[model samples]
Target: MRQRGREGLREQRPVATMEAAEGRLSSEDSGEMGGGMAAAAVEGIMERIQSDDEECRVQAAKEIRRLTKTSPKHRRQLEGTVVPLVSMLRSSNPEFTEAAMLALLNLAVKDERNKIKIVDAGAVEPLIGFLRSTNSNLQEHATAALLTLTASSINKPIVSAAGAIPLLVKILRDGNLQAKVDAVMALYNLSTLPEDINTILAAKPIPPLVNLLKICKKSSKIAEKCTALVELLLGHDEGRMALTSEEGGVLSVVEVLEEGSPLSREHAIGALLTMCESDHCRYREVILNEGVMPGLLELTVQGTPKSQSKARSLLQLLRKSSYSGSELQAETLENILTNIVAQIDGDDCVGKAKKMLADMVQVSMEQSLRHLQKRAFATPTKQSRTKRQ
Candidate 1:
């Protein structure tokens, strides 16, 4: 009787287990079916987008905007839809134009190929037109779209040639907050091309850029790009003069050096270095007045390798200028250097710090000699010119 009871329990177990397993399989099948249905829906939308019916095209563009906003897979699969979307950018209706631009921006987010394709489809000229649009939303979207498209190195020249820089500078001066931020980033991207630097400078971007940097967070991405662009701009005399002329411009860069991220601090220091190097007598006092010592000292120990090197160099420059033939000033600089080296090498490594200081002095002396030699050779005295004659 006990053996028969055991056999009866085993016979009932399979029936319940089989039903549970079948239920899981049915759910998985439904999930796959749902995915298939979604793909089919996207296909239908693409068909509508390509058709000659204006209403269908408008609805389809809206749907593409929604679908591609958060779906990387859809963006990849919809590459062929780029030309149609670019065509919609020329629509007279504001809503249609915005929807198409937003969709194109979304599609270009992470896909490099889509960015190039969109630019190749002649989307740039219309986008430039939208940059001057009376509708704020369209202008913002146009700036953002150019920001995305110019991120591709191949599209930089194409967008630049379409007369986008002047309009971008205009946006920097007059557009809303978001548009200003996007315009700066787009300009930064274009500035990567060696040839576009002058073109950007010609737009008189410094005052607006300085204002933007002054208002934004020091550690934010916008600040990083702003400083980076400012650094690039410093390569030209017009850019350098523009920055110095802008109110609070030098102070803004000094603030970044003190409180910004590592990359930003690097850029900030670079901008300062550029100014001081360009015309040391003119800018040395200008930079020192901004109270840049604390940030420069901190960066000596805490910054990236390139930044640390720059910090040391800038500190040397500032130190040399700060000396007024007074023992008090000399002692203060000595104490500052001692503190930096101690922080770098610790109390136990005093010998190492001494060696490092010696090396720095040696390097500075070598640099001074080179500068004197350059001045000697670059300009000829009366005797040398007479000899040449």
Candidate 2:
């Protein structure tokens, strides 16, 4: 039996030899392993982060932040390192907080496991509180981390339930530009579900959100996100009422349609369409009073089919509220046909179409005024008689 065992061991030698020849065998003779070196580096940084020396902690944090941003490899072995990093967030030391937050931000980004680990380490609450930080950098970094953590399916409600929503809205309202953008994006992600939308609306954020739209320049990234947020906010019952209640909402949306990105315009059209879908007479008059009907009309000719469809749907809703169907369609068709003829005759289609709609709106307004004046003169009150005299 011993002799057969020796023969079997000897037969395995060829396989080991083959593995070595293919460079598949772990070998000390191959020099220091990159994995070993990386592990050692991470362990050393972990020690520095926990060091009594504050400078060492900051340096370690900066190094860790750089490493995490460049790759996720070091994060795989982050178990021993996460606690000190999270603890540093509560430090009275602002540098420590910023460094730790940046390190954690980079560490948590694009790594769901790391995000879970950070949240498990009790990072979410402090992060939420930090959203109100007077330190813009810290606010920015904390928002970035929460944005990543909230993206985790497991962490979404954990974040919202922890009171992150209202603070996030505050950040969206008053934080620095980048902080506002980050906060708005975080809110956008959190507002993905119906429940999340209700939670956000309960925070009463529509006015500030509309303010954000006005504060950001036209065609800016922040404007795009604010427009998108309005689209979602319009999806909820409270959200729609909140939007309609906010005096700036309709005009802000219309401004986006005229000046924002293509996606912004598309979303603006959808949001207007949403407003018109609600049976409330005030909602229809709200957008119409913004004088956006001409822009809405232009969209029928120039918008994507989906947005054009939305524009047409909105026009149908608006016209139903104010005009008889046949009259409205005849006016719209006459304007479109005249613009089409001019377009074929080498005139700018947009220019001609806008002019045609302007003329059509003018005619409609004149006829409506004539009817109102006739009704008024028919009554002929005392004040009217004085004016007539």
Candidate 3:
């Protein structure tokens, strides 16, 4: 009786297996059917976008924006729609232009190939034109599109050559808050190229950028980009001059050094170091007058490795700038050390501050010696291995 019961259960297993297989087949078929529908929808949207009628094109662009906003698959399928979307940007109608620009922007997001494709389709010129639009929304969208496009390295040179820098600077001065933010990011992206630095400076970006940084939170991402660009710009004499000319520019950078994120602090210190290194006589007093000593001292102890190194170098330069000749330099260094300690901890805690600084310097020297020893030992080991080989 038990054997018979087992046989009955075995017989029922095949029916269950058939039912599960059919369910899986039905699921796969539905997925394929859904994909086919999506593909068809994309095809219809593309055709309408390419139509000669303005209304049809506008509607299509709107659909493209809607579709690409949330669907990566739609973005890829709609790649061929770029040329038409770019063409729509030339429409006299602001609504038409914005719809198309936004659609292109959405398509470009996270799609490197589409970014290049949009630019290659001649999107930069119209985008720059929109940067000058009287319509705030249009101008903001245009700035955003440029910002998105410039994020691609390949688009940087092309966008720069299309004469976007001056317009971007203008936006920094006159655009709404969001537009200005996007403009700064776009300029930073372009500034990554070595050749574009002078162009950026020629537009006198320091004042506006300095003002922007002053208003923004010190640790915000925009502040990081602002300081980074400022650091790069200071490598040029004109840039340094412009910064000094801008009221509170140097002060703003010092503030970042004291209060910004790790990378921002690195840039802030680097900009100061560049100024001092370029011409200590001209810039040293300017920097020290801003109460930079406290931040420099703090950075030496607590900042990133790069920031720490830059702080030490700048501090050394500041010390040297105090007096000429070796003997006077030695005396000046001691006086400056006393001043730094006093500044940080007041007269009462000078002794304690000095002790702490001494301990930090000692630890730094010990680490340097260890690093040098490792390199020294590594050289001989490599040489002996070469000989053995």
Candidate 4:
């Protein structure tokens, strides 16, 4: 079997072996044209992938894995290999089946064309089937394959239609740490589309997902993906309720915004923005009371373009909440006070209005002075930086 894979690789070597010559290219090598495999090489691998002997097929699948990993061209050229891989996914031999699934997983690696081929070849159902297998390794590989397949914009619905959500949720609740990460990461990707949010939420993954967010180390990739998933989930009403109902729910998100990785912080802000925009008055008030303004203001100055936009929008919402739109809006505190003063008469009754307006102006001035002092402290020198909450 090993000899067979070697022979198969040897047939493809002229193009595949160019890496060997990369370091010592004489003038003749510079003139040599690039190369690729003949059809026979693919045929040999495909034949070995389906060989009656189990070891031979595993060897073939592994060679395919290596080729797919090393060469993007091999991944794209896998039109013939995907069909056999998809078929072998259902094989009764667990070891061979695992090998085949992993090979397909590798082939689908960041290669959208191969991903499409795997999906169209009917790999979803069998992969979802593996999720329920007593074999944890098989489950891990299957989750990984589903994760890769979902990266394509078109494959999310396909995987979801195959009833992957509930199975993935089960893995989230029961699988090893690595498997749990892959499962939530896939859920995060699926939730990228509004249409899939219902599918994910219907699976009831929120409890475990929120738990995942809370228990994982701060700013880790798992927590990052979990936060991103919750951010998307928060767009729906049910999602919002589930999240807030969880212990440390809103605060968990806020903590991530305060200290997670830059990407996690971005997602965390997105989640908070969704909450602040909710029609539920409690949502906005909770965020405001959480002392999010200072952190959001910091983001407006130092965050990425999108993060800055979101932070500014949230800050504007908070400001709008401070004085209801029904009460008034003005370019500045002076404008509002000027309007009030113009409307007031010298009557004793109007003294209350003038006094109220004067109080507003004084409070505004004090707050502005505080902001200036805070900014001065936060930005006095190149090394000075504000801490966010």
Those runs of model 2 whose alpha carbons end farther than 4 Å from true positions after fitting are 1-37, 74-80, 323-389
> Which numbered prediction scores highest in lDDT against the true structure?
3
TM-score of each model, paired residue for residue: 0.76, 0.74, 0.75, 0.70
lDDT by residue for model 3 over 70-94, one digit each (tens)? 4567678899999999988888999
Pick by TM-score: which candidate is best?
Answer: 1
> What would the per-residue lDDT of candidate 2 be over residues 1-389, giving only the tens digit for each residue?
00111111111112122112111111112222234236677778878999999999999988777665535565566656778999888888888888888778767766777878888999998888787778887777787678767767788888988989998888877776656666776888788766888778888878787877765655665666678888888876787888877755776788778656677888899888887786646676667655566567667766777887888788766665444323332354446545644655445665655554544453244444444345335643211111111
Please estimate how well model 1 matches the true structure, expressed as its whole-model Cα lDDT: 0.72
lDDT of 1 by residue, 1-389 (tens): 00111111111112122112111111111111112226677688789988888888888887676666655677777777899999989989888787788778877876788989999999999999999998998998898888888878889999998899999999999998778877887898899898899999999999898877766667666677789999999989999999887766787798778767788899999999988888877887677655465567668777999998988788667655533331122233346656866767777655654444443332233334343344335543211111110
Clashes of each: 0, 0, 0, 0
Itemize residue pairs with steric clashes in candidate 1. Answer: none
- RMSD of candidates 1 onward, in order: 19.6, 19.2, 20.7, 14.5
Q: Of 2 and 3, which scores higher on lDDT?
A: 3
- What is the lDDT for 368 in model 4? 43
lDDT of 3: 0.73
Compared with the true structure, model 4 gives a TM-score of 0.70
Q: Which stretches of candidate 4 lie over 4 Å from their true place?
A: 1-35, 38-40, 288-294, 319-389
Report every candidate's CA lDDT.
0.72, 0.67, 0.73, 0.67
